[model samples]
Target: MSAILEVENLRVAYPSRQGPVEVVRGVSFALGRERLGIVGESGSGKSQTGRAILGLTAAGGRVTADRLHFDGIDLRGASPRIWRQLRGRRMSMVMQDPKFSLNPVMTIGRQIVEAGRRGGVSRRDAKARALEMLEAVQIRDPGRVFDAYPHELSGGMGQRAMIAMMLVGRPDLLIADEPTSALDVTVQLEVLGILDDLVRDRGMGLVFISHDLRLVSTFCDRVLVMYAGRVVEEIAAADLDRATHPYTRGLLNCLPRIDAEARPLPTLERDADWAR
Candidate 1:
């Protein structure tokens, strides 16, 4: 597969009372039509990197990169008109929570149809695609969900709806941020499976950002471990257990195993030098 997105020496900064605080520093990666996992703790800039790719950073924030390309388009130089054309059409994002992302007044079907319509589909065709996507995400009753409001759905249902909305546009790249964090273990796996299948069937590139190292290791093809706003390690998911970075090893050691004897879990030791 060819590269769909390429980012190099990316940095994001926000002005603070003290000064400009940098959240993401010198991050670089290339993504193809495959699942790429970004694992990091809270405040590690994982989400910021995803947002920067879609030009969704805060109003006062600044994003600078030596190279930021998405499917041969220069994201850094893209105009608002260009961004509007590309955002929902070629690239879409599934945010962390549907409760916050979805409009309360909009029906589930309306929101999904709107997503498709933004990509230039006719309203009638958009509605049909919305129903198809709802079923595609494993929702049992697509009609019931189509008419329901956001608050009427359960967490898992809401998430499935969110996925349906994002995929309704048939985007080539999907950035899913903590997509399964709020679900139960069973629901999480189900959602992940849905995403995996969709990516495989559509041949879309996925950037899966999450704090759960174990989940990412099992679900993703490759892993990028972040600490203090920078990528500290990059390794294949299958070789996650053999990670050489101290931060990656620390995170792996922190996960409690089902077969392990009863013992206290090790605490993650922080090193100031790792941030430099």
Candidate 2:
């Protein structure tokens, strides 16, 4: 598959009282029409990398890259207008939680329709597309959900609605930041299955960012292990157990196995050099 997104030496910094602090330092990766998982501990800059790609960083944050391209478009130099045209149209994001991401006042269907409209679809057509997307995400009753507000839905339903809204535009690339982290194991698997099917059927690229090493290994094609704002290792998901990097091994070892003997869980030992 051809590359859908590319980044080289990407950096994101913020001005601090102590001077400039780099949250994402020299991160680089390429994504294709396949599921790519970014796994790391919290504050490791995994989310920042995704946000920088979408140009959604905070006002005080500065993002710079030697090369940042999306479908051959130079994202590093993209104007605000260009970004507006691209974001939610050619590319979209499914954030961690729907309660915070969704508009509490708007009906779920209306939000999905608005997203479709942003991609240049008419209101009438967008509404139809919204219902279709809701159903595509496996919502049993699309009509009922269409009229429901974000606050009226359960966690899983709200997440499915959020997915519907994001995918309504039929974006080429989807950045899902720990999208299933807030759900139960059963719901998490269900959501993962939905995402898997959509990516396969739509031929869209996915950037699945999460700290769940086991989940990512099974659900994604490749995995990028990050530490201290940098990619410490990149390995095929199938070969995750064979990862050589200490950070990756540490993460994998932290996962409790069902067959393991009863013993205290191993604690991850961090090396300061990994952050350098």
Candidate 3:
């Protein structure tokens, strides 16, 4: 079967006095109804690659690809109007920070309901569906959650609410950019479980972007190890223990282990060739 989303030779760049700062250089990948994790250190361009496909590049950043398709639709040269219509309804992104994503003045319920409304759901039915989604994300006291403002919720609650809102449209492809980064460890696992359930139940494709190599190895089905602005390795998540790329091996070596030995975890080694 063809991929639900596919990107080929994608490159994203920002103009700088030092010339163009290329953030994503010739990166490519495909996704099906499975969890695909993109992992790398800070400034590795993992997040930039995800946002480029979703038409959410930062200011002054330009996105280009030889071919970018979503659900069989060509997205390489799609206009902003077309992108706006495609985003949120056919595909959605869950940002890292809900505090910035959610409107400060709007009630949680209102924002979630509006998400459904944009997808052609009626006002009343959208509210009902919003409540149901909130429940699905393990948000207790749905009534209070619905009525409260964004500022009234805790970080975990807010993140769950954001997930609920993003999935309300039943988007075919979901790009989750460190969706659990702000939450506690326990909450992080809880949120991961929720996302797993969504993929299983709805057959949705997921692109999970994060710097947490250990977490990604455990949670994702496949992993893409990135360095600088390119993918250095692609391996099965379960096989991350035996990954071959120097960068991948370095990451694993740097992780703290339960059984072993060193007072301080060994630092990862990266060579200039790792960026090629």
Candidate 4:
């Protein structure tokens, strides 16, 4: 399969009073038209990695890499023009928190319609396409949601609307940061089905970032276990139990198993050496 994204020694840092603080340190991965999951704890830099991939790193953050290429296009110090040309049309990201990502002032429909328009969708068809995407994300009432403001919708509804917005353009590479985190189990499955179909049918390359290791194992083809701004292990999703890294093993052991009974749930023990 053709590689859609490439990264080598990718790093993201921010300026502080003392000096530069690196959040993502020398991370590297390549992506194809398949599902790849990155799993780690909250501060493990999982979300930062996804944001860096899409050139959405925070304003003060500095992103650098020996090689960061997307579909043969070099993304190092990519201009705003280049980002605008690629984002929403050929590439998109479903951010983890819709409350911060979505515009509070705009109606859900207008936001989604704008995304479609970015891909050159005609004004006449944009609304129809927007509504279709909302329904695709398992929203029960697309019509009502279309007119609702971001604050008017519940957390789950806002998340679905964000998903709808990102998918409106049918991007080739989708970097999803906990896309289904806010939804119920049933809706989570529906969203997963949509992503799976996009990978299988539309040939979309997906980078899934989540904290749920079990969910990643079932949905992704491969998994990257990150710890302290670095990937500690890379393994096939089906073979997670056989992971060699101690951090990965510790994480797995910490999970509660219905099959096995443990009076106290184990907590992850960290190793300072793992950061190196």
| Pairwise lDDT winner, candidates 2 and 4 | 4
Kindly list the per-residue Cα lDDT of model 2 for residues 44-159, writing each as its tens digit: 99889999999999899999999999999999889989999998899999988898999999999888888899956789999998998888767789999999999899988898
Q: How many residue pairs clash in each candidate?
A: 0, 0, 0, 0
Question: What would the per-residue lDDT of candidate 3 be over residues 1-276, giving only the tens digit for each residue?
Answer: 459998999999999999998989999888999999999888999888888988889888999899899988898888888887888787988988899999999999999998888756799999998999898877879999999999999987898899889988888899999988877787687778878987889888999998788888899999998899999999999999999987888888887778988767587866988777
TM-score to native of every candidate shown = 0.95, 0.94, 0.94, 0.98
Model 4: lDDT of residue 78: 82
Error of 2 at 64 (Å): 0.5
Per-residue lDDT of candidate 1, residues 143-208 (tens digit): 999999999999878988998899888888999998887677776777788778867998889999
Q: Candidate 4, overall lDDT?
A: 0.92
Local distance difference test, per candidate? Answer: 0.91, 0.90, 0.88, 0.92
Please identify which of the two predictions, 3 or 4, would achieve the higher TM-score against the true structure: 4
The segments of candidate 1 whose C-alpha lies over 4 angstroms from its true place after superposition are none
Candidate 1 matches the true fold with a TM-score of 0.95
- Candidate 3: which stretches are off by over 4 Å? none
| Rank order (by lDDT, best first) | 4, 1, 2, 3
**What TM-score quantifies how close candidate 4 is to the native fold?**
0.98
Candidate 2 lDDT at 269 equals: 92
